[model samples]
Target: DWVNLEAHELNIPKDESTKNEAHWNCTLKNRTVKVLRRWLNERATYDKYQDRDELWLTKKATPYSSKSCNYLLTRLIEEGDVPIPEHKEITWYSIRHGVATHWANHVGPHHAKEQLRHKSVTTTMKYLHSDSEMRSTAVEQIW
Candidate 1:
């Protein structure tokens, strides 16, 4: 998978009943192997990260709670002067949604579902709205 579970220290379920069902294998291209290696190396250089077992460590050397990554990204957006078109606020989820939407348009929705790890294509289908231009072209073809 693009995001290798092997690289991240996962919290394995202790309940034996659930353990077998907890994990799914996905594949990423070999192209990311070097990028993954670089991220791991970068993570190692942080202060106070020595005792941390989590995959993503905060700059303060603490383990990332759910909000911390978002907080960091928000800070980066402000610091980097990233222009938000239409004054739209951005979130990680928005990025993920955008990727899934575009991917579904480029590839079929099934591939997008795999990328997003959606159990059902219905979940991915939400992102697959047809563009007006595409709709217009379809109408022309029918005429």
Candidate 2:
């Protein structure tokens, strides 16, 4: 329901698809906390709906729908001049998968499952990606 700046955690509300779900606490890294703080300060300067319960608001002080979020992300990427490889696409799910993969690689699948809030490790495995480099490293370690 709220973000705890001191704890560096946010409460993620359960969506309609989540069965028997309550809120989940997602821990934020220090860098994420810093960025969020900066965003809050900056947004307050120009946002008329500062008192609104919604975390994100458009310039017109309206809540952002999924489509608007996608548009905003695309616009930001273009305006920021971020380069994308040919045939490559970036979406919110890309970031989610990246985070899930990082946890699965560095730690373990059980940990990744927790990080991703998946009910099963099998579900978490779908987000993990293994490249040639990782395969090579594993083969070398075995030999």
Candidate 3:
């Protein structure tokens, strides 16, 4: 829980809708932990619901729903002056897919599957995609 503040990991509670039947622990990157700690400190100064397990809250003092979270991400992307391609839209799941693709390409599908916490590697393969560089390298090696 956010209230406990573990040094290097965050506990994710299970959600049946997402197929997560048991709680899982995600180890954080060093930079992520630092950033989260700083945010928690700042959040503590203003958030009235300090006793709540949620790490984030809305202006109305409620936990953010997934839709609201995505809206906030879009707003942040816009406010940060990030450009979006003509026919593409970025959402939270797309960002996750990008990460999964990166891991699958650079590390391996098995490692990517473990990182994604998927019960089966088949599901992880859906996010794995071959980029131009990888395709070029494969052709070179085959020739």
Best by lDDT: 2
Ranking by lDDT: 2, 3, 1
Candidate 1 structure quality by residue, lDDT tens digits, 19-105: 244454444445556666687789788766666656566666677764786787788999999887887778766777888877887
Which residue ranges in model 2 land beyond 4 Å of their true spot? 14-20, 41-47
Which whole-number lDDT from 0 to 100 does residue 49 have in model 3? Answer: 60
lDDT-better candidate, 1 vs 3: 3
TM-scores of the candidates in the order shown:
0.65, 0.78, 0.81
lDDT tens digits by residue: candidate 3, 1-143: 52235658776667622567676666687888888889888877874767776677898888788788889989998999998998888887788898889989988988888778888899999987778998899999999
Question: Which 10 successive residues of model 3 have the least lDDT summed?
Answer: 1-10
CA RMSD for every model?
5.0, 2.7, 2.6
For model 3, the stretches where C-alpha displacement exceeds 4 angstroms are 2-7, 15-17
Tens digit of per-residue lDDT, candidate 2, span 63-129? 8886787787788899999998989878766878989988988898898987778888999999998
Candidate 1 local distance difference test against the native = 0.68
